[model samples]
Target: MPVITVKLAKGRTVEQKQQFVEVVTNEAVKKLNVKEEWVTVIFDEYERENWASSGELHSLKFGEGFGMKGIEK
Candidate 1:
């Protein structure tokens, strides 16, 4: 089985995750020569505060609740 792990800042909808999984699964099946059923994908979501780049936390750099609906800017 092919296990793939993707880590990203949390703020994605189920639909987005579904779409991403579908694409990754298909690619793994095709390029890795694995069966669709044997392909496994795991999402490791993180808070923006936990994710940092360029010595700055994403939460502090991009503001809280980026891309999430109903969140105050």
Candidate 2:
């Protein structure tokens, strides 16, 4: 069995998370040789205020760095 946990800021749509889970689970199944039924993926969504980068609160300072740029594409 393989267990994977991913943490990200909340607000993604259901479709986005579904795609994420599908891609990750498939990769795990292929790389780890785990059965699809034995692979588990958990997404933990946090508020922007609860997450940070570059020592600044993510909600307040995320746009100034590569954060917003990465998401734009």
Q: Number of the top candidate by TM-score?
A: 1
Candidate 1 overall lDDT versus native: 0.82
- Stretches > 4 Å off in candidate 1: 66-73
Model 2, residue 52: distance off in Å is 1.3
Following a full C-alpha superposition, what root-mean-square deviation does model 2 have from the true structure?
3.8
Q: Encode model 1's per-residue lDDT on 1-73: one tens digit a residue.
A: 8888989778788999999999999998888898999988898988888978899987887776645532344
lDDT digits (tens) for residues 1-73 of candidate 2:
6889888777778998899889988988898888999988888888777877789776676543323533453
Model 1 TM-score (2 dp): 0.83
Runs off by more than 4 Å, candidate 2: 63-73
lDDT of each: 0.82, 0.76
Q: Whole-model lDDT, candidate 2?
A: 0.76
TM-score for every candidate vs. truth? 0.83, 0.79
